[model samples]
Structure formats: structure tokens, C-alpha cells
Target: MGRAPCCDKANVKKGPWSPEEDAKLKSYIDQYGTGGNWIALPQKIGLKRCGKSCRLRWLNYLRPNIKHGGFSEEEDNIICSLYISIGSRWSIIAAQLPGRTDNDIKNYWNTRLKKKLLGRRKQQQQLHPATTVEHDHHHHQDHQQSPTSTSNGLSNSALERLQLHMKLQTLNQNPLLHNMLWPKLHPFQEKLLLQAMNDENSNNNIMQLPLLPQPIMMESPLSNIGNMMNNNNINVSSYGGAFQLGGGDFMMGNLDNGTTSSLVWWSNEFETNDVNYDRSGSFSSSSNDSSWDCALRSSDDAGLF
Candidate 1:
């Protein structure tokens, strides 16, 4: 059976809201309260908004004592810690923080706290880091270097670093910048990625990657050592070592340290000299395709879409 619509879709206002609508929602809620039914509240207040939109506006923006702008270190810690513990349960994380909504917390994490974490991770690597293998994603000649061959240069700790570096390189390809942002492997996934590596190193040259603990088999660009990725839907392609999904870059460091981290948002700016993509990630020049771009963006946003 099909699901019911939240309200009469044709009759409601959408997109960025108007001041009048805001005032009406705020005033009505202030005077009488939501009565635990946001779906009905819009109609009660005589505003032409879908109940979900009305609820989001009120909960995220209009509600009393709601804090807007600038997260504190405490809030950031709360967000990051909760994220690491619970994994993007924004509503739950927001509850631990006073006056912050799930949307607000989510936006901050996506745009700011994410960068902060990457910056810190990068710093830690500088002090006691993995030997990074560089690969150029733009030129096919550069990709010919191959991740396994790149790691062949590493004298110490080749096995662990080699597996993660290959996995990161295989995750997506923009540059080393893109690998740093690949989906953070779940505990099970991290094990699985390395497991695939161990199995390959001990025996075969190429192997198929297992799905993210589900029923389907996943195809990954990690076709070199088989495939490497941590998600079910996260389809990736490998060109030698540089994996290019959409943003076109990737880097992995120090996974053996077990300082577990997951994919947040892309933290770096796109290079303009030769690299270019719009907010939607469609290539502006000839040979344009954004299927991977669309896939990663949707996964990054989770259910927000």
C-alpha cells in the first residue's frame, strides 16, 4: 500500500518561508501550543504549509529559546562524541545540547565540525603518521602507478598501511584530498576491508568485495586487490590507485592506529587550476557525468533529502 501525503501537497507553501508565515506559526504556537500534533497544527494556525515543513520551521527556527549560530567547543565535543558513539543521530545529539535543533546540529557538523575533525586527524598524522602514497587522479599516466606498486616503496609497515592506502585510493578519486573523505568504515567494515586485503595478499591478485553485511555482492574499483569499500550502496571505480566516484580525490592514513573515524563532509576547497565542478558536481566541460556525485551526495546527507 502507498503512504498517505502529509497534507494536500498542491495547497501548501514550500521552500524558504516568508516572514508572515513565520509570525503566524510562532504566534499560534505561543498562544495555544502544538497540542502534540504538528501535522494538524498548520491548518489550525491557518497557514498553507505542509505539517512536516511547519514542524521543521518551528522546531529548527521558530521555537522558544532556540539557539542559532556558532557552536561552542562543548557543543562540538558533544556532537562529535555522540556522532562517534551513535553515528549521526542528530535528534539525539541535539537533545544533549540545549536549544539546538537536529537540523542546526547536522548543518554545523556537515560544514564546520567536520573540517575541525579532519584538521585534527591530519595533525595527528604529522606527528606519528602513516607513509602516504600519492597518486594523481587527473592524468591516466599517473594512475598507471597503481596503489599496490605505490606501497611497494614503503619499507616499514607495508601490509597494514598498504591495505588502508589502497582502500582509500580505491574509495574515490579526486586527489589525495578525496580519500581523506571516504566513508568511515564501520568496525565490521574496517575488519572486512583489511580481511579482504589479507586474503588477497595470502593468495589471489584480484577478488570480489563482500557487501556491507547484506545480501548483495558489491562491485568496487578496488578491482586491483578485488575491491575496497565500507558501504552497500557505495559503488566506486579504481583507476590504478586513484578511485574516482565524484569529488575525484581520496587519502587514507593510520587506520592501524584504530583511531576510528567516519566520512563527514568534504573539508577542502576544489582546485580551480584544472579541476571544476558545480555545487551539484556536474562537470562543466565536455564528458560530463555525475552518477557517482549524486550517489555520494545522497549518502552524505543520509535521510535529509
Candidate 2:
């Protein structure tokens, strides 16, 4: 068997409640209370309304000091905060605001507050437009595999990867991105440094070569990367709270106070050992067989290891 309807839909007066009906409901509830039965309360008040309707009308409207509108700033903050935390649980949110009802808060949010927030977002977007880059591979004309060129032959994706590697090197050097106020080592200089650090076979040869000049006041690597991407019709964006380079294949730690919490490297076409970089420029891997060990330091600091 199914549960019975609360009231006869045909018999109950629906839509907006009248002033006379409101007065009757309020006066009866005030003098004698609901008598603990809203279903029978309508019968006592002689009103052609459903029990649920009577309860809502009393609790949301006719109740003492039921605030109608003109929601204050403090109320708005509470509503927004609760909405963020508990979502659209209006009754629970309303419990925090003494004079407000769930219906009022919900209606206000849907009608006015939602649009207001969206308008502010639109304004912010207009002021500082978000960067969204899309790479299409069908446009590549040739295939050439080299240190600088992949099978795609300098495609947008390859360029993105190069830029990502460059960004990683930049972060590995400073970990502060542009905030360090330090000059960036050139791409050639970075390559030389990497070779000098990683190439064990050429350690004697590298030692004989003249040392690279210390980096001086130059453009920030971040700014340089941005310009490069913009010129190539691509842009950099943060991914999952981490500073991502290019299409997010390489992600660095959060740029918080010149300190990196973590770094992760990913490749779309190759399987490589996952590496983690910390603020100290030390690298570690989860794989046991991996022997990758490198430490990148700033020019002003000790030499790279």
C-alpha cells in the first residue's frame, strides 16, 4: 500500500494566501497554538488550506518576527558561506539566521544573489581574461625526430613540451617563478648546466670547459615563457592548484612565498619514472630501480649537483 496524500488537492485553496487567510491562521495559532496537529489546525481555523501549507505559512511567513526582505550584509555572508559549505540545504542554512526562513533565503539566492555573483564574475573575467589554449595536431606539415624536434616536427604540442621543460628548469632553479626577482639562465646555459650535472662520461670534458657566466638581472623566466606562448598563440595556466607549464604535462608546486610544496612530471607519449622535486631542489622517485639523482641550485647559491 502507498502513503495517503496529506490533503485533497482539489479541495485545498492553492496559490497566494490572502490577507484574511493569513490573519485567520496567525490569530488562531497565536491564541490556541497549533494544538500539535496541523492537519486538524485548518479545521479549527476554518481555512481551506492544506496542512503542509498551513505549517509553511505559519513558520515561513506568519511566525513572529519573520523577516520578509532587506537581507543585511551579515546575513548575506552567512548565506554565501553556508551555501558553499552545505550547498542548497536552505533549512539548515536558515537556522543560522534568526529572522530568515529557508524559502526566503532560497528565493533570494535564486533570484538576486546568484545573478549578482555571476555579474561580479563576468566583470572580473572582463578585467583579467582567463587564458585557454587549444592545440590542434592536424596542422603539422612534417615529421622530424631530433633533440629539438619530435616525430611531429616542432608541432604545437612539441613546442608546449619544450616550454614546459623550460618552465620546470626555471622552477628547479628558483622555485619562486617570477617572484624571486632573479635573472633567468638562458636555454643554452640551462642545457650546459644539465649536461655538466648529469653527464658522468663527460665529467672530465665538462671540467676542462670554461665555467658559464653567473646569471645577472634579466627578464623573469615566467614572463619570457608567457611571451613565447603568446607569440605562438598558446598560454600557460595553473592546473589543480599547481603551476602547470604549457598543456600541464609538467606541473610544479604552488607558487607560495618562493617555496614549492611538490613537483610532478608527466609525459603523454612516453613512460618515464615519476619524479618529485621539493623546494630544496632535490629529486626523488617512487620506483625502486630508478637511479635518477640531481640537485638544481640558483646561480647565487652553490653549484648544481
Candidate 3:
């Protein structure tokens, strides 16, 4: 082994100092003021701790007049601005907040500011409600006009409009589908889908959707068949035919000629199937499905499905 460690490696005390240790450390530091070498401070202080431990104890725990407890409104503003500007550098943020330690600021931000920002975002989204590119641009303009518009809070209308525009934009961007699929969805269903999409969207444009609260299985298998007939656009020439249902279900009815995919929704559920057509004309179905099954737990929950 190399030479023994520089400092004693056994029975070194840890954690908050006792009153006597605190007084000894404070008194020694008051007279000598660190002397530019932490490795020598503990010896000078006549304490059991090593110099490194003494420095940590002083800076982190026993520093005179350390500000503790909740941060004020001014501090909250500074922290938010710094976070938006610099990301998660807690030490940098702490420097701007006098008397506050980095750990303190970090805790307050995690516990208070984060929740406030999330709530403000959700409320803003609910209020503005945009559904198109033009609407989002208009809302952006409105927000820019307000002098007090820091990222902390924006005009609720603007937020809502941006959210709506984004939702529509996402659906539009997917050439595989169309908005007509949801043309006649119940208001609650529309809201649920929007919430889910918002949660999934990387832009943080909408509040996350809560986990499904209950389970929903189709009341009858026929419900899926009916739903499948209403929503899909069938390509009669390529795959023999395509089918879709009213509640956002779709299917390709025949696969022998190359059409064997279908999407189905029933009892507030959704699923998709890829069927392989054999030379003998038999179609084998392999399905990949997902749905808000919880929405069917009770009649009151039906709106979400």
C-alpha cells in the first residue's frame, strides 16, 4: 500500500457540531479567518474535526446569520429568470440570492417554484385554447405586447391558443391520419385526447394527463365492429376495401390482395391489427392495441373515453 492517508481515517466525528465544538470553531475562525489553508484550520481551532470538516461545518451549517426558511417573492423572481436563462446551475442562482445557500434555493425551487410554474402553465393552457397556426401566432403577438410578460406567467388566452394550435399541428403533421376522425367526438372525449397528446408532446405545451382512473372493457364485441366501420377510409382497389367506425375505429377488411390492417375502438378502447394474408386466402391477425380503458369504469367516466 502507499503511505498512510494524510489525515486520521478512523473515529472522525460527523454531522452537526455540538455547542462546545461550535463555539471552539467559531472562536478560532473569528480570530484567524481560515488563514488560507483548510488543512491546518482544525488544529488551530483545537477541535476533533479535520480542517476540511471544519471548513464544511462552518460554510454549510454554522456560518453566522445564514438565511433560512422560505424565499421571498423577489428571490423567486430572480430564481425563475436565472433558471430560464441558465438552466439548472443552482450555485449561480444562489449567488444572486443574498444570505441564501445553494441547497436552500434548490429546495425552495423544487418544492415551491416548480409547482407554481406547472400550475400557471396548466391554467394558462386552459384559458387560451388555440387550435391553428394563425391562432398561435396571434397569441404570441398578444403575449409580446404585455410588459409584465416574463416566462413565469403569460396571458392565459395566448397559452390556450398556442396549445390548440399545437394539437392541430401535430395531427396535421401525421399524414397517416386526419382531424375528421374526431369530428363528432363528445366534448369530454375531445378534452381527454387533447390532455393525453399534451402529456405526450415534447414542447410541454399542455398539462400531463392523469393516469387512467379505472378500467373499461367493451360492453359488447359488436361495438368494436361498428366503430371500425365508421372512421377509416377504405381503398377498394388496393386491399379489396378499408373500413372505419364512428368512434375513431378503422380496419382494412381484406388482406389476400394486400389489405389486412384494421383499427378498432369499443367501450372507449382503441386497438390496431396487422393481418398477414396466406396464399390460401386466410388472414392471420396480430394486434397492437392501447386505449383509455379506465374511462369505462363507470357511466360518469364515459365522457373521457
Candidate 4:
């Protein structure tokens, strides 16, 4: 069975409470309060209004300090933030703002706040169209330059670096750089590069290296390793027979003579020099491709080469 109505529909007044009605509701509530019963309060006041209508009038309008419209910047921010988090729980949102009603916030959000945000967004798009376009262009470039793309099976950056290395005559002279660049190259790939080096008929010094694993292309260049370590505040030095830093046992490499520090090599600048051929018929160049150029070798280490 349906529930009975709280008040007689025929006798009750509805919509837009008059000034007299507002005064009566406010005056009675201020003096005696709703007497813990809203359904009986309208009858005591003799307002001819429903209990719900009287309650709404008292709480939303007739109540002192009940704010309506003209929300402040702080209130707007609070409303927007709460809306994003809680989503249309206007009663909870209303609780956060001292004098604002749930209905007022809901109406303002629907009619004004939403449109205001949308208009501001549109203005931004119009003002900075190039920014959006540039972002999309960068995204497209990243997608195109992915590792899957073909350039001897290398990513765009790696391929560019490789091409740059190929142009330098120094690369043909040093085999150590090749080993460093491709630390784990397969035997077949090594054979192909060796064959290319031996080919006398090859017009240009540039040799096509086989498709290597992505890690080979991504290894940090030796020149930048010092800078990277310095940025992270890593101070490498031999302490207690172990190459360590900041009291932590890092175990980077073997110590030189147990006393000589590797900090000189780690901290030194790797400056490039002009390319030159060695006297032993092997073309050697004092550049980044030649690791021997940077190494501080003594007469005792001559036979190790």
C-alpha cells in the first residue's frame, strides 16, 4: 500500500513563500526553534504551508546568514575541487561552505560554473593553438622514431649517432670503441664488420653495422658518464681495497696500485683532438672513438695492448 501524505494537499499552500510567511517561520524558529518536529511546526505557526515547504523556507531563505548567489573565489575553488572529488554530493559540498545551500551550489554549478570553465578552455585553445599542434607533432615524431622503425633496426637517435660515427675516420682505426658500443655483439655480426674493414674495393670508410639489440644503442656514452655520476653526487675512490663512494661499497673497477685514485679519470674532461694516423700503419685518431687517447697508460702496460 502507498504511504499517506504528510499534509492535506487541498488545504496546504505551495511555491514562493510570502514575506509574512517568511517572517512568521523565522520569528517562531528564532524564539522557540522547530520544537523538534517540522511536520507540526507549520500547523503551530498557522502558515497554511506544507511541513517540507516551511522547512525549506526556514533553512534556505528565512534563516539568518543563508547566502544566495555571488559565490567568492575561495568558495568557487572549494566547490570545483569538492565536485571533482565527490561528484554532485551537494549536501557534503554545502557542509564545507558555511552559509551556502546545496540547491544554490547545484544550480550555480549547472548554469554558470560549467560554462565559465568551458569558455576559459576555449579561450586558451584559441590563444595557444601552436602549443597543441607542437605537442601532437612531438607525439607523432616519438611514435615514428620507436625501436620498431627500420634504420638498420635502430631507433632514430641511435641511427643518427651511428651515422655521425661512420663519417669520422677515427672510427675505422679503433676497435675498442666498436667493442664498447656493441659490448655483446654476436660472432656473426663481428665477422661482417671485420670483413667490411678488410674490403679494399669499398670506396667509402662508412660500414653498415648489423641490427644490434636495443641496449647496444642505448648505453651511455663514456664522455657523459662522468657528468652523470657527478650529477648524482657519486665520488668514486679506492677505500679499504674496494672502489667505493660515500662509505658504500660500489665495486666499480680494480684499483690502480692500491693507492692511486680513479677519480682523475672519472672527473677529467674528455676533450676531442684532431685525427691522425699511427706510425705502425694502423690509422689512429685522438677522438672519442679512441679509448686509448683518454687512458693514462705507463711503459709497463705497453705489452697489454
Q: What is the C-alpha RMSD of each candidate to the true structure, in Å?
A: 18.7, 20.1, 22.1, 25.1
Error of 1 at 89 (Å): 0.8
RMSD score of candidate 2 (Å) = 20.1
Error of 2 at 107 (Å): 0.5
Give the alpha carbon lDDT tens digit for every residue of 1-305 in model 3.
Answer: 79966568574676767989988888877886878988777766567677778877787667887798866765665565444323345775666666888878877765666545433434555653421111122345545433321121222222332233234334533321221121123333345545443433234544222111111112222233233222323222222233322222222221121342222222212111332212222122223332222212232322212
The superposed Cα distance between candidate 4 and the true structure at residue 77, in angstroms, equals 0.6
What candidate 3 gets wrong by more than 4 Å, as runs, is 1-6, 119-305
- Candidate 4 minimal-lDDT segment of 10 residues: 263-272
Question: On residues 208-229, what C-alpha lDDT tens digit does candidate 1 reach at each position?
Answer: 3221211011112111111223
| lDDT of model 1, residue 26 | 90
Give the distance in Å from residue 201's predicted Cα in candidate 2 to where it truly belongs: 55
Q: Identify the runs in model 1 with alpha carbons over 4 angstroms from their true place.
A: 119-305
Candidate with more favorable, higher lDDT: 2 or 3? 2
Q: How far off is residue 252 in model 4, in Å?
A: 43
Off by over 4 Å in 2: 1-3, 120-305
Compute the lDDT of residue 62 as modeled in candidate 4.
79
- Per-residue lDDT for 139-236 in model 2, tens only? 24312211332222232233333333333344444322233233344443355434432342222433222112222222222224334335544434
Total backbone collisions, model 4: 0
The per-prediction tally of clashing pairs is 19, 0, 24, 0
Model 1, poorest ten-residue lDDT window?
Answer: 213-222
Output the worst ten-in-a-row residue range by lDDT, candidate 2: 130-139
Q: Sorted by TM-score, highest first, which candidate order results?
A: 1, 2, 4, 3
